[model samples]
Structures are given as C-alpha cells and as structure tokens.
Target: MCAEPGHYKPLDAPVGPEPVAMVPVVQLYARDVPGLAFPAGTDLLQILWCPLVHEDDQYAANPRLLWRSTELTAAGTAAGEPPRPHTVEEDYLPRPCTVSPTAAVEYPNGDLPEELADLLDERFDDLKEKQGYCYFEVATTQQSKVGGYPGWTQPPDWPHCAGCGTRMEHLLSVTATEPGMGRWLPLDDRDPRQGISAAPSWQAEADPAALDTFGHDMCLGDLGGMYFFVCRACPGTPYTHRYDC
Candidate 1:
C-alpha cells in the first residue's frame, strides 16, 4: 500500500508530503469507561492518527480525536473498510486485539505531592516488608489505561486547555510498553526470579511470548507514552495531549 490512491480527496495540508488516509488507532464507547465523561449526546470516542512521525508535533504520531453518537450511525449507512495509508511507519502500527478493561489502583510515577511523597516513602518501606513487593514495582501500572495517573517515564508535562486556560484533565495514556516482567508480570507466566540463582534469569526460558514481543509493539520514541487530555468545562469538550518518554 505504498502507492498513491486511486481516487482524489480534498486536503487541508499545505505544500508538504502527499496526503494519505489516517488509520484507526482506537475506538471507545461510554460503556467502556463509565466514570469518564463524554460530550453531550455522544457515546463514542474514536481516535485515528497518521502513522508517521511529525517533528513539529512533538516528534510523535499526529493523532486526531472524534466524538460520535452510536445511535446516529444507522446500520446500513455504516461505511465499509477504511482506506489504508499509501505510506506508513510500520513501527507505529498496532496489532488488533480485544480490549478487556480491568479495574486497578496504581501509585503515581511523577505527580506525588511533596508532603504526600514524604508519607509515601515511609509507607513504601513498610509495605515492601509486609507484602514482599515494592509498591512502585508491583502497584504502579505503566501500561495503557483509562482514568488514572499516567505512568510517565520522564517528568510530567500536563497540558492546559487552550480555550479556557485551565489545566486539562488526563483522559488516558497510550503506552508503547505494557506490563511484562518483574512484580507486575502476569501470574500466568512463570516468575523470572523463581528459577535457580543464575545470571540472565529473565531470559532463562519461560513464556516466549512475553519476551518475544511487546504490548501493541508501537515505536513510541524510546518507550514513551501519549497522554490525552480534555477540558470538560468547555463546550465540545476541547482536548489536548502530552507525550513523553
């Protein structure tokens, strides 16, 4: 699909690279995250992006977000397969997988209040002794999730609303890496620390799928993550995003 399109379509791009169709990144309904607010009368949130890097736009995929009402799209009027991009960054593409939402609590990676941080440091040590698990290692989630602290690999960069000038609420995080090894590893997989005391223990033959691949496997710039934001106070629910490693 590296060739030009058969049909022509209007574009808003200036003199730049040839325009190409954007691909579906993700689609979510109100039912998926009941606590999250949706625009008035809209029950669905659809996200698509150009699967190519944009240096001007934080050197990451240029994502476009849309809010839709499911009741409005009649079954017959629903479109067929979407047009594919003629040129795409293969590393930006994600594998098709069913989303099974799970409820969880995670400690913040970067946004702990100063006073709370003092208390948390003391509590972390106590919890590690009692639970035999580092709270940061076991409780913090650095994977894709809805309505929780973003597992930032770097310092936090929260965006403010352009329309109202208030700090935007973090909607979700789309990360390149998901939970795999360490205390956060799935119970179904054999513990990397369980086998004999040997070097290269993590690679000592167990759950090939775990080591062979990564969650979604998208090249998000040194295992970074994209944080979506929204201003619920503004009309149309104006949104923005922040990306970091």
Candidate 2:
C-alpha cells in the first residue's frame, strides 16, 4: 500500500552523521517587519534552523534565512522527504512551535555611552521608582517576536557580498526568545507587582555569578544574538551570518 500524500515516514534506522533538521519557526513578510528595508522583489522571509548545533559551534544551533519572492514561489511544491542526519544533540532539538510576528520598537544598548546611561538613569529615577520600571527596561522592551535582534547595538555594517559587491541587507535575527527583555512582556502577561521587587528571586535562581539573563541562557553561554544578511543583488547567492551581544 502507498502512504498518503504529505504523510511523513520515519526511516527504519539511522543513517550518516545525524542530520540536523531545519524547521521553520517563523515566517515574516516585508509588512510584518517594519523599519527594516528589505530589497525590492523580496516580500517573504522564512526563518529556519537546526535545533542542534553543528560540530564546529557548540554554543548555538545554526539558523538560516531565506528571502523569497512569494509571487514566484506561490506554486512551489513542498519536499516529500527532507534530509535527516543520523546523529543529533538531544539537548539542541527544538520542540515544534509557530510564531506570530509583532512589530516592536527597540533601542541600541551600546548606543548610549556610560555617561549618557547614568544621566538618563538619574533623570528617570523618579519615574522609574513610581512606575517600578527602570529607564533601561523601558527603553529596551520589544513586543513578542521570535528571531529578531534587539537593537541593543548599532545595526551591523554588513559587508559587501563576495559574489557581487552589493551591500547586504539584514535578513533575519535568530533569537532564543520572542522578546528577550522582561519589560517587553505582553500586557496580558505582565505582573504589576514583579519589576524591581522580583529581582531578588530572579537573582537567587540565576546561574551563580554567570551571565544569566532571560532568553540569553537558552542559546550560547552569553546573552547575545545572531544576525543574518543576504545579498539581494545576487538573489541566488549564499547569505552571511554575524553575532553580537
């Protein structure tokens, strides 16, 4: 008997080096990502990645971003049998989840020098105290989103594509959490009583003196984000990746 169309069949046994599967966690269209200037002709962005890390990078799984032309791909067929490597890190395996992109405003953490940060902190102390939220927290909050970098740092100076000298455009951000900051917690999910007052509890449970922060701990040892850029000029060319905290 033949299997039903679209039904996935597991292999009887494992094959070569465990193939890390690339699964789609989210899909964003040009409209979904505001402020980002996607190149013309590219309207769809697909974020996919292997949950497990490759042998070279033990810190985080590899993420792939594909800038697609929906009009050109609307009739494309789905693969019947995706590659499955034999061995994979069990810890890196991701539980299947879908994402709904939400537009958010973010500021670069590095944008403010220490002096400016201190000044702002002092200026906002009264409001922070009254609102029970810090200036930094307020400045960094982003709505629920997956795979987008915090504007904590200046936008990367993307290198020119090697194949074509076109300046690459930021395609997607692979992040562990939708919104890494606690302040960005959705209004429905936010607890009015849990800002500074909850710090003690959070600290107590945190990894001893380590760079433990929400969302950051899920990936590499540090709380940073990975960014991917594509050479829109060369549509079929490979993309480049960059990392930052």
Candidate 3:
C-alpha cells in the first residue's frame, strides 16, 4: 500500500522492495518517448541505448547486427558488485495514494452516514477502469476547515494548528485508496474541534478571543485540496452553525 490513509484496497501483496518512484507522466507529450525506459534497479548515471529493429525479418540483413541491452552501459559495478539486470515488470498499477480517515471518530454523515464506505466502492470501480486518481477535496460540510496565508500556502508557515499551536508539518500518513474513491477526509491532526470557518465572523464566534485579536478566521476551502479537522484539546469554538445549513 502506498502511504496515506482512508484509502481503498483492491488486492493485498506482501510488502516487497520499497516502491520505485516513477517519472511523472504529466511531463510527457504524445509525440515524445522517454529517452529510455529506466527499468528497475537501474542507476541514475547509467547510459542506456535503444535498439532498432525491422518489422519482419527471418534473419539479420547483416551478420554484425547487435542487440542492445536495456541496462545502462556506463553503469559500473564496484569490486564484488553484481551487474544490474534489466527486467520489464509492467504489472504495477499507477494510482494516487489515499489518506485514511481518523479511526474511531464519528463523522457527521447526514443522508448516508455510511457514505464513506460507498465512496471507497466508487474509487475501486475507477481504479478497475483506470479512470483517474483521487486526492483530498474539502467537503462542503466538514467541521474544521484547513487554512493558509496567501502566497505562502505550503504548510508549516501557512497552515497553523490552533490546538497545539503547531504548524502541520508531518503527514500522519494513510493507505492508498482505489481510484475515484471520492473519500476526502478531514485533516484532523490540524483541527479536531470541527470549528473551522470560511468567514472571519464565524471564526470570531468560534473563538471570541479573536474578536479583539489580530488572527484571521480562515476556512478549509481557502486551502486548496486540504481536508480540515478540529482540535479536541482546545474546543474553544462552538459547533459551527454553517454545517447544518
């Protein structure tokens, strides 16, 4: 399972070697090809060569024809180092990792309280079809919303936690969910009280001390793609009124 949480699992495999980081496919264009397939176990500095072949030929036109090895030629093995072998294992599926929901916490699910399970099912269908991957999208009604200051919204400096007075730096990871799960979770580590507000006034109501203070009352929606959670330690804010509306 790729790390994160609240994800859906299709099949289980004994943990193998740590997964290899793939080159981002978004950078590739249709007309272009990867300089060479960086097969498993290939070193970074190795020079790979691609072999050219004719569509059909019983025998080589020239006796001196050479077949290329997928492994990088320049990649050298130190003393007692085994030569890296090239293997083309194309069985791995590409999907975004899933973030698991907080265990044992009750979600305020209204119409379908068990919707989270259903969301996982939908994600599985998408993965089977290879449609696309899902990341955390803020729900319209999650209790606490994540926040960040403009221009520097990359966490630590941006998304601050009011409870521990700490910036959410570490990702308490979860499992990889199936594609299209649509199970965006609340960023509970950041906020567990479920009192995040989109408006400054709502925040003021949540924390009346902020009424005369300089802090801004930001909501989770402002932080693009972040799921917010409320802090239990500092339940200073009242239950947000906007959740029911």
Candidate 4:
C-alpha cells in the first residue's frame, strides 16, 4: 500500500523497548505559549523526544518536557543543532517546522461519558453560554502544539504528586498537530493542492520517520499526545507525565 505524501508506512521489522537518541522538537518560552502559569524562576519549556519506540502503553515514543531557567543556562551564543537518534520509527518522527504558538479556547471531547459530564455541568457551564457549546467546548483554550485539555474525551483525572500528595497543575501538552491547524488552515495555506510534503533532507537524514510524525506523534494509529504537570506548591518535587490517545 502507498503511504500519504508526508506519512510513512509502518515498517515490518520489530521496534523498540530501549532508549534511542533524543532530539529537540519544539521549545516555547512562557511568552510563546500563553495562559500557562509556570513556576517562578523556570519559564523555558522544551519538548524533546526519542524518535524510536519506547515501552509505553498507548504510544511507543514518550516525549519529554523540561522546565528550565534561561538566566542560568543562557550562553550568549547561537544554539547548536539538536542531535539525531541512531534509529527511529518512521511513524513516530516529527518534521522540522517553525512553531507559532497561538492561544485558543478548547472543549471537552463531545463523546465524554455522560455521568462525568453531568457531575461537572455547573463548573463546566460557568463560562458557557446557554445556547452555545458546553464550557468544555467553547470556553477552554487549546494552547501551543500540545492538545490542551483533551478534547473529544474526558480529561484524565487530576494527578497527584508522589511526594506531597498535592494535586498537580496542568503545565502543557505536546501534540502531533498545532491547535486548529486542520479545521482552520491559514489563508496562505488554504490551497487544497498544497497537500502534505515530505520532510527536508536534513530532517529526513536525521531520522527517516521525520515526515511521518509531522505536526504530532503517532500513537497506535491515533495521533496521541503527552501531558505534563508540575506541583507549584512543592517547588523541588518531581513532576508528573501522562499519555493519552
């Protein structure tokens, strides 16, 4: 079977349970991705990943999120290129494209369990208009490339910190596609003939699967995403990571 222009057919060979090289996919400063309240003194947000498969339940590759203090790490010099992995799943790699993070309101997945939605109806509807879509739909903003607040599905329960048992705050999401890139293509990108294209040689050479993972990571055929949360109260505590389809 033929693959889509920017997508790759899954390989017949077996893939991973080990770590592959990691590369930086996107980096967002607190200013770039709005609405997020980062812990004081740590404002840089980076999303990096190993293109190869990992031992994840929903997806093979687990992307990593790091919060850093730019003042301490800044080297007053141009940044070097990110290193490439030795091997990767063609379907789990991402293309090299610039990110323009825009703020957007998001909604819960329309198919969430009725019982769960019923329980939060008052809270969800607080910002929702009587005649419009539910609060989860119209009032939430899906920021950056990460799929914010898990639309089309109920969000995973709030995670708790292992150390303090305090509920963590939603930091950000790392997603396969930028928010609203599909349903609302930009004016310059509106041509239907302008279909997906292959990744450039530099990206493809770094990892052949680069084109396949364009915009978002592929998780078991569904474009899956990862969520990161940090405990604001406990500054030194470990953060939490969650995977969702």
Best by lDDT: 1
Candidate 2 collision pairs: 18-85, 18-86, 18-87, 19-85, 19-86, 108-151, 109-152, 145-178
What lDDT does the true structure give each of the candidates? 0.67, 0.49, 0.24, 0.52
- lDDT string for model 2 (1-245, tens) is 11112212123232234344565545677776675665667888776656444433224455667778888878785768755433434333334444434345655454456787777776678866786756555554332243343433334455578897877765565544333333344332334445535542212122222213223234322344556767756757568766544
Compose the digit string of candidate 4's lDDT tens values, residues 25-131. Answer: 66778776666666668878776766654554444555666778777658543578645665666556666666544344455555356898888878666645554
Model 1: per-residue lDDT, tens digit, 1-245? 12222322223233245676777777888987887788888988887877666655466667788898888854436478867776566656776654555566666757777788787898888987986666655455776777888777787788888998998898888887654432233433444655534322222344556544534667577678888989999888888777886
Clashes of each: 0, 8, 23, 15
TM-score of each: 0.77, 0.56, 0.15, 0.61
Which candidate tops TM-score?
1
Report the Cα RMSD per candidate.
6.7, 9.3, 24.2, 10.3
Instruction: State in Å the error of residue 20, model 1.
Output: 2.1
Evaluation by lDDT, superior candidate among 2 and 4: 4
**Residues 206-233, model 3: lDDT tens digits:** 2223222321122212322222222334
TM-score of 3: 0.15
lDDT at 199, model 2:
47
